[model samples]
Target chain A: MSQHSIAIIGVGKIAVDQHLPVIAKNPAFRLAALVSQRGIEQAGVPTFRTPAELYAAMPDLDAVAICTPPSVRHQVALEALNAGMNVLLEKPPAPTVSELADLVRQAAARRCVLFATWHSQYNAGVEEAKKRLAGRKIASLAITWKEDVRRWHPGQEWIWQPGGFGVFDPGINALSILTEIAPEPFFVTAATLTYPANRDTPIAARLTFASDAGLPGAALTAEFDWRQTGDQTWTIEIVVEDGTRLTLIDGGSKLAINGNLTVAEPMAEYEGIYARFAGLLDRGESAVDAAPFHLVADAMVVGKRETTDAFEW
Target chain B: MSQHSIAIIGVGKIAVDQHLPVIAKNPAFRLAALVSQRGIEQAGVPTFRTPAELYAAMPDLDAVAICTPPSVRHQVALEALNAGMNVLLEKPPAPTVSELADLVRQAAARRCVLFATWHSQYNAGVEEAKKRLAGRKIASLAITWKEDVRRWHPGQEWIWQPGGFGVFDPGINALSILTEIAPEPFFVTAATLTYPANRDTPIAARLTFASDAGLPGAALTAEFDWRQTGDQTWTIEIVVEDGTRLTLIDGGSKLAINGNLTVAEPMAEYEGIYARFAGLLDRGESAVDAAPFHLVADAMVVGKRETTDAFEW
Candidate 1:
């Protein structure tokens, strides 16, 4: 308990931009090492090239933060779990839901901690929104998450790679938030995804969900796009039966109801995530949510086919 | 247990064609009553307009099988569980993975059994195939699941509806088999989903998975298409390190390895599933495999999207 010494796999932008600073600020953790193919320094931590090498050398590390692409996180997580270390996995736990299940099973078998951190779920206003909306009958809900890929991702080619999740990479942030805030259980009712013909993933998508049979006349709809021209948007607005509308903007940091300001809080996504992870680790528990990924899968499982014009970056 | 009186919910085509006759043959379960929006009839048992009305009226019903579309199965399952009844839920268990988890959690909370039945996983040859493949390093896998939706599903529009899981409705059957046979978890590396313009879901998709980090050399590639003519294909072929190829036909009824028929078994998909469910119920335990659904979801979350030509009936 002195300090849960942790190493990080896949030292990429997120490792630098969010994870490192969060660890640095939190006294509950100590940055032990960073494992990546190139062994790059995300603000100067010890580096290891592969999971085997990292684990064999660092026997004292208690946990590992997996920041790799979804495709490879499972293998790394499995290794960490097998080596009797806890895991703090990034969103979309593994490249596929199946892999995540295996990881879950493995973690349970090993009695090691596994946390699937949906950063968006930790927004400052999320807990407040969830508490307020619970049991309140929802009339209609809409979420629009669109951003220009070039502006947001810059040179991150992995975003377009096979397991990169393309627009969904960012779109999942919205899904993570929705999964947390929805008062009732909802599933994808219908969806239309648009892919840049040349890319391996969708560039834009329209997703719809309903509360049980899409009956009761309650609905949830989401639009995720990487082609928005101006003003990056990540917002959710819900109209309840009582004739009040709740709007959460900048991905749950600010909120308004009926055009009146309710909560205008600052972003603390990663901070909240780390605090939650620490709690889980402290309690000998595992926190894994596969709902957000399941919705995305439902879209692929049910969505119709379309071929847009090829995109040339 | 006195014919294990069971009620069928959401009596659709699958119930009439598969569930009823199977129940009749089993002799272990008796079709006590059926609950559907539109009551269906055959012989013996009466039908109720809804699950609430049926369960309310029948105190003799010992178990319930909720066979609705994936989108709404969770509610019926939850309802059945709440009524102090063991539940046999069709594939999906619910519209979303999270819902499935909730059902799993709910059944535990109530101490009543909930069965997430994957009809295909019980295929006659699956166990034999799984035994043969276990512990052996899998080199690669190929799943080809193609059928004429118009012929099989006909005017059943709900199959293409979101949460209905489009081609994955069938493809997931393939995954159920793959997940059972494989030794380790695999993640989707790349995918191109082809959807028809008129529909909200994809008609065809190519999904690839790897045991490691999108390793270049060898892996499993699953191909699912709704547009098939003449002889339909549902098969899984595994390539091993010894240069031997193994194939299972009729969803694991027949198996052959390296040009020699290593095993050719009978089809018993439904019975196998029921047998396992019975065993689980006897042990007061749950055997749920979310691997198939997770794989599908992970692919959707990460796979790039594309749209193809419009599908016509």
Candidate 2:
């Protein structure tokens, strides 16, 4: 296989912690360059201040993995596609549904690989859970995603701003897994989004969903909170019509069915993402799943907002 | 051609004002039934209290035009689709993008024609405007839609409730026209949505857009308000790269290009919609354009909120 030369745009914490190491381990890709405004660097790799400069410097670069914030992902990915390179986008893809949709069209028009990766959907347990739940009707589903924003984000000011997604930033991981595994398409029927008194986005949300195949009395719901300080929880429990229960715990890194531990392994989500990107690049296919993003945007559109206490770091 | 038997669900103001008269004049269809809880009726047309009753009594109905409020449109349309009938939806389709998407799938699965009608896009002026702007780039575009909520929605309690769409109920009409005529796709870049202190939805909004075709310096913007007491306005002015200006006035009923009035005709948007539905039924096709709805949901996702004075009837 011809190794694809890829560049990492936006060397933030996710890029440094997950993407860089994942790319280094994947033999299908060679880290060709980096673009960062902070002038961050690594040994033996070219660094450019901006994507435009990188494009000019390395005209033959095969692809770019955009690790920028969701607000800027669309523009950076568009530029990369315009410059004749494949692109990869992190979770939530773009700030709004339309932006992600626009990128999908641009990528298809340019005949380049565009992979919108959901890290949570890349785990083995998630894949197995999807298989177990296929061809079945969900009688009930519950998603509880609670985390400490201060511990996980650590002074990330953007989370409290408009379009930052606040609690949804982590909640969407559970949604991605759910959208992938659910037998039939589902939609947000009702939502209550609790906004911090001093913030522009919600600090917590509760959403109710129903499936196209018709759920049992709209028994699907999710609760997302960003205020947990002890014992972070990220879990989804589903009960199918046949009385079989499947549970994905720890953000899909483990799965249990009918009180039996089915699949539990060390999480290698980013590694799986890179491997899938390599396959997509080889086959010239683009995978853009708008389902998870649509649910988030739908929650925003249909949700009733309530103002709560102000959030502090 | 055999006349199609159709029904009108939720006989509200729009049903009485538009759908009833349009169906009466069109030879392609016969008004089969009416579904309304208010016990509304028309001469020689049977009225049923619910869709389930209509489906049971009129099992051979060919199609249904759902004119219910946006919040309940999906469930009504889905039931009609499941009963093996083609469906026509009113403007803005369902309350959320995902609900609309689910209906589209269910209709296709049942081999039923799903026509999501945007009445504003049916005008001759809007069509001409679209033709003129084809293959051209936009330099600047501005949409101003202002109307008095009291005059338009008088005592409609749902408009102030969550998922009611409030000002967006009318604003989406402008967007439907915009999405149909624009040469390329555009996305919400930034927006300020003003919500009334006592309401769950916004009463006004200001949005900026950027096209995938790359508009000239992001000069596309819109202002939607429901506070205009008199001299109501619904207009969109666009300037192309070659300095050709096209203006749609009076809610796409009239068009002027470069200060020359090119098309002006009596508005017959609902008639056009039914005519198109007849053709779609004949061809066994489903026309579901999700662009306009996506833009509205996108605005909600990307918009910053500000609170205004409490709204009262």
Candidate 3:
């Protein structure tokens, strides 16, 4: 088997910190080129200022990973798919569900692999959690994801703009993991979104969910806030019908059961994503999961809005 | 063929104005019962305060038309499906996409008929427009839907509350027609939502769309407002690649092409809905088109927000 030639688009923080390093070590893919507006380039790789240039120069490129902002990802991926190239999109796929839906259609129509990767769902703990809760009925589940936005996304103005998702940027990672691990599908029942006085998006949100086959007294809820100053927390706790408890901590990188540590390991999320993408490309299949994105859009439509203190850099 | 015993849930404005009359005249259904929170009742029909009571009392009922508020339709229809009854939902189906998705799943799993009726799509003019646009390329499209909320939705506090779509309540009608008539799949590209200072939902919106196969210079847009005081307007104008302009007005009840009126008739939308429902029930299949609902949710997620003047009853 030969390695698939792939180019990385958008050489921003996530691409440099995670995607580039992971592709460098992965034997399934060879880094062919870079398409960056900032003219960012890598050693021994041709760089283009636009995707059209990349497609023209490397028409035989097997695939392209789009790491652009959520707002522009749809157009970028659509152009790549039109050029008969497999495409991979970063988390929160596109700003709108319709854009993502269009990409799914285009990918299938063009017979190209389209992988919408949620980096958090690639952890071993998340996979184990999904396995453990396969046939079990959930009595209750709670997700608490609170972090300092300035600490993680400093000087990122796009996060506050329209289509940026604001606090939902990190909150969707929790939803991605929840969708991956939940035994039954859940829908948002109620929500309250808190927007900064000067921002176009919410800075915090509280959501309640209901499952199809949930038992009596079942409670499903999530709280996401970007105001945490210290001790960042990203955790999900689930209680099954048998009263056994399972907890996923550190954004699904560690797992514990009944207050006992069961699995704790350093996460190689991007590596797992590339591996899955490789498998999908091999089978000529597209994996475009809209559950996590749907949940966020559901919260936005069904949730009540409140004004909070204005956020600042 | 035997007449199916059906019940009307949520005896509200729509139920009284449309569902009862249509069901009374339709030969395929028998009005079995009514579920109303306000204890509203009709001549020669059983009335129950809750769905639980209705289900317990009428276990043999074959189907139910859920005319409840969009916020509670999911729960009501789910229970009806659980009781082995087919369900038909009003326009917009549910408040969130997730809820509607759940209903579709439940209906399929239970082998019950689930018909999500977009009343505007039931018009003869809309059907004709769809037929004319089939296999044709779209050049441009515009939707203008403006109405006085005070006149149409007078004293309806739910229209201003959370989970209430506000202006989108009427705007979705235009979208329903658009989804029915458009030859190619289109997605929301940009939007601006205007919300009253004292309300939870938007009072006006402007949307821009992009199509997969749209011609160059194609401009697709919509303007929805609830502040119109005089004559109401519900219109859609479309231009194909061949430069023929097609127009639909009066909420999809009338159509014109190139200044020539082609189709115009009194709208019997509810009657059309029941006719379709009977066909779906007979075939044991479900028709849940989420395109219109998805566009609204997509706009909510991707659109910028603006604060307008306070709205009052």
Q: Judging by DockQ against the true structure, name the best candidate.
A: 2
For residues A1-313, what per-residue lDDT tens digits would candidate 1 score against the true structure?
A: 4567888888888888999899899999889888889858655567889888888998878898999877668777888998999999998787777777778889999999999999888876777778878878788888999888878888777777766777878888888888888766677656787766677777888887866422376767998888887898988988877878888888889888887878887888889888888888888899998788777776766554455788655
Tell me the TM-score of each prediction against the true structure.
0.87, 0.94, 0.92
Q: Clashing residue pairs, candidate 3?
A: none
lDDT of 1 by residue, B1-313 (tens): 3357788887887788778778778867777988878767768888898888887899767788788876677777888888888888888666666677778888899998878888777765677678877767766788899898988888888776655678888898898888787776676666776757677666888997777422348767999988898898998988776667888887777787776776676666666666666666667777677778777776666555566787777
- Where does model 2 exceed 4 Å of error? A56-60, A212-215, A258-260, B1-3, B37-40, B43-60, B212-215, B242-244, B258-260
Global lDDT of each model?
A: 0.79, 0.90, 0.90
DockQ of each: 0.54, 0.75, 0.73
Per-residue lDDT value at A41 in model 1: 69
Comparison by DockQ, 2 against 3, better one: 2
* Steric clashes per prediction: 22, 0, 0
Which of the numbered candidates is closest to the native, going by highest TM-score?
2
CAPRI class assigned to model 3: medium
* TM-score, chain B, predicted structure 1: 0.93
Error of 2 at A91 (Å): 1.1
Q: Residue A264 of model 2: what lDDT?
A: 95
Chain A TM-score compared with the true chain A, each model in order? 0.94, 0.97, 0.98
lDDT of 2 by residue, B1-313 (tens): 5689999998988899999999999999999999999999899989999999999999999999999888788889989998998999988789888788888878888999999999999988999999988888888899999999999989988888877887888898999999999888888988899999999999999999988544558499999999999799999999888888899999999999998999999999999999999999999999998888999898888789999999998
Please give me the DockQ of candidate 2 compared with the native complex. 0.75
